[model samples]
Target: MPLGQPLRLGRHSVFPPLLMAPMLDITNRAFRTLVRGYGGCGLFYTEMLNARRLPTESAQSPFWQGLGVERDVMVQLLGDDPEALARSVERLLPLDPFGFDWNLGCARKKITHWGWGAALLENPQATARGLRALRQATDKPLTVKIRLPEHGHPDLFKSFIKLLENEGVDAITVHARTAADGFKRPARWDAIAQVKSWTKVPVIGNGDVQSAADAQAMFQKTGCDAVMIGRGAVGKPYLFKTIINQASGATEPAPEAAKVLEAMLTCLDTALETPKGAREFKVFCRYFAQTLPVPHWFWAPLQSMTLGPELAKRARVFFKK
Candidate 1:
C-alpha cells in the first residue's frame, strides 16, 4: 500500500511517516536541506552528535552551522554519560526539534570503544541509566535508533527492548540488523517484524530500503509505523519525494542532472562558509558522485577540488555534458 502512516512522538506528529535515517557525517544541514527541498521525508535526523561534546560545541563549528536548514528534525545523540547527555538536551531544548533520538545502532569502533552506541545493547545497566536520564532531561519527544542483539546475545536484546518501553521511549527505530552484521550483510527486515511483536512503542523500520517498492514491502511485511531511508537517499535527494508520490499514484519528474549538480554546489558553497567545511563537502560529494554517469571516473575529480567556486564551475561543466 502507501509508504506508512503518520508517526506521533509525544507532542509532535510527523505525517507520511517516511523518515531520513540518521547517518554520521552525511545528514548535515546542507544534505537535509537538499532532501527536504525534494519533499517526501516527514522527519529528518542530524548526524549523530557526541553528547558530551554537544554541550560545548561551538555555535560556529561545522556541526552546529549545518543544523538550521530545516525544522521537524530530530537530534540524534551518541554517548554514555547521562549527566552530559542531560546537559546536551537542555542545550537543544531551545532549538525545538521534532524530538531527540538516542542512538544504539552505530558499530563504529571509535564510538563503541567509549561504551556507547551499539555497545550499550550488551550493557543493560548503562542503557537504562542513559535512557532514564534522557527521559528526565527532556519533555520533548524522546526516541531511539537501535540494532537487533549481537550474536549469542538474544537475551540481552529482549531485555533491551523491554527496557526501552519501560523507560518511556516515544518511538523506536530498528535498523533491523545485529550489531555484528554491519553493512556487509543484507539487512534482516524480518528482525524488524520481531521487534514489532515485543514492543508497544511505535516502530520505525530501517535498512535496505532504496525505493518506494522497498518501503511498501517493509510496511507490509514488518507492520512498522514508518520506513527510514539511509544510504539510498544520498544519490537521489528526490527519492523520498518519488516514494511519496508513487504511493499516491502520481509520478514525479526525475531530477535533472543539472538541477542535482546545482543543489550539490549550493550545499558545497554553504559548507565552504566555515573553516572546516571542505571536509564536509568532500564527504557529501562521495555520495553525490553516485548520480553522475560514471561515478568512478568523477569521484576522484570531485574529491580533489577543494574550493567551492572552482568545484561549482567544474560541476556545471561536467553535468552539462
Candidate 2:
C-alpha cells in the first residue's frame, strides 16, 4: 500500500489527500456536505464558475457558499479574459476558500467556444496572462487543472507547465488524456511520473481513478501527491473514507448505502438553497442511481422524473430496509 498523508495548501491541511474533482453539476453544496459526512476527502471544489458570470452571482446562492461545518472548499474559475478571471478571484474572497483553481482542462465545446477552459491551452501566452492576473488577485494557494496536449508531446507539455510554475502555481492536476483522445482511451498512468519528474510544483493525478485501489496504484506507480476522483465518487460518497480505511489495514465496510442516500436527500432539503437546485439534483441522480446496488426499477425513471413527492416517495421505497 502507498503511504497516505496530509497535504498543505496555503494554510489548510488535506489529510489523506484524496480530492473530489470539481465537476460541472456534480459538486454542489448539498452533495459535498453529504460526502464530507462519510469522512476522508481533503479539499472539495465548487463547480467551475464562469469568471464572466461570477461577479453577477449572489453570494447567498449555493454557488458561492461554503459548507457551514467545514472550511476546506476551493473555488474553481474558468474564463478567457485575464481581467475577468482576476476580478472573479477578488469577488470570491468573501467565501474564504481554501484556495483557487483555474480550469485549464475542461474540453466541453461550449466552454472552449468562449476561449475558456482547454481552449486557453491553444495560446500559452494568453494562458500566462490570465495566470499572472490570477496570481495578483490572491495570496491564497492557487492551482490549475489540465489535460496533456493532443499527442502528449514532451517538449510542449513541459514548456507549458514551466509557464505555470513561473507564474507561481501551487499545484497542478493532470487528467492524463490528450485533448483529442477524450474518454476513448485509458488514462496513461505512467505519464504522471514524467510530470512529477519535470515539475517543482506538486502534481495531483486525475483520470480513471475509480476506486481506492486505483488511488493506491496511482501513488505507487506514478508517485502522485494526491488522486482526484469525479464520477466514481458520485454513487459512493464514502470513497475517500474507504481508501483511508483500507490503507490503514482496516476492513471496515462503507456506511450503509441506504443511509448515505437518505443523508444526501436531507442535505438537499436543509442546506443552502439555489435557484438551480432541481437541475443540480437531476444531474446528481444520473450518476448516483447508476452506481448503487439497487435494481433497475430503482433508477430507471430517475433521469426523467421530477423531484418532489414522487422522487421522495420512490427513494423511500426503493432503498427501504
Candidate 3:
C-alpha cells in the first residue's frame, strides 16, 4: 500500500521509491546523471564492481570513472570473499556512497566463474557468512540483489531471505527469476509477492518493468516497497518521469521526440569525455534509436555509426522534422 513514499533502507531514505537498476557499462555516471535530469527515480546504482580489485584499482579504472563523491549513488560489489568484500567496502567508504549492494543475482558466466554473483547462492552457508561479515564491517545501509534458485524450493528461498535480514541486511531486490533461467523466463511477480509477505525489510521488485502500467502492476500485485527499472529505461530516460507522474495520479504524457533526442545528445556529450566515447556512443545509440520515430529504420542505419559527431548529425536530422 506504499504509494510514492520514500523507501527506507535501514538509515537511508530513497525518495520517490523508484530506482535505476545497475547494468554493466550502461549505468555509468554520465548516463545516470542524464537520467536524473528527468527527476523521478530515487536511487541509482553503479555497474558491478569487483570487491577483490577495489583495493588495488586506480581511480582511472572504469569502475571509478563516473563514480565521484555522490551519496545518492549505490556501488554494487560482487565477490564471495568475506574479508575481501569487507576490505573493499572499507576502501570505498571515502567515496561516501549512499549504500553498498552485493550482486547476488548476476547470472553471467564471467561473474559465475569467479564464484561470485549467483554462484554464491549455490552455498547458502558461505553466502550468509559473507553477508554477516559485510554487515559487521560497515554501518552504511547494506542491500543485496538476488535471483531465485532454478528449481522451486519456496520454503528454502524464503528461509534464505530471512537469514539475510537476520544478518543485518536492510533491504532486498528480487529480480524474480532463477539463476539458471536468466532473462529467458518471464519474471515471477508472484515470487516477489511471496517475499514481500514474509519480510519486514523493504523489498524492491525488478524485472520486465517496461512501462508505467508494468510498474503500477508490480506495485499493486506485489505490494513491494519499490520498483527498479532496467532495460525499460534504455532509450527512455523520461520513463521515470512518466511512471512517477502516473503514480501520483497524473496522466502520462508521451515524451516528445525532441526531448528524447536531447537526452541522447546530453549522454553522448558526457560520454564523449571518455576514451572510448565513440564506441560508447555507438552502443548507446543502439538503444536510444528505439525511441525515435520509425525506430526499426533509424536503428538499422545507426548501427554503422561510431563517432559522436556523425551520430549527432544523424540524430539532429532525424528529429528536425
Backbone collisions counted per model: 0, 0, 0
Worst 10 residues of 1 by lDDT: 61-70
lDDT of each: 0.82, 0.81, 0.82
lDDT of 3 by residue, 16-122 (tens): 88999998767777678778887788899988889889978886776666555555888899999999999888888887888899999899998889888988767
- State the weakest 10-residue window (summed lDDT) of model 3: 286-295
Predicted candidate 2 versus true structure: per-residue lDDT over 1-321, tens digit per residue: 745566656565577789999988779878888888988898899889889988877767567756344588888998878899888988878667788999998888888788788887777998999999999999898999998766546898889989989998889998988777788999998878888899888889998877888889998889888889888898788888888888888877666656876788888884413436766766766677666566777678765666444566667677664
RMSD of 1: 2.0
Q: Give lDDT tens digits, candidate 1, residues 37-107.
A: 88888998988989989999877666665454456788999999999889999887876777799998898
Q: By TM-score, highest first, what's the ranking? A: 1, 2, 3
What is every candidate's alpha-carbon RMSD to the true fold? Answer: 2.0, 2.3, 2.5
Clashing pairs in 3: none
The C-alpha stretches of model 1 lying farther than 4 A from their native spots are 66-69, 273-275, 291-296
TM-score of each: 0.93, 0.92, 0.89
Error of 2 at 50 (Å): 0.6
Q: Model 1 misses residue 141 by how many Å?
A: 0.9
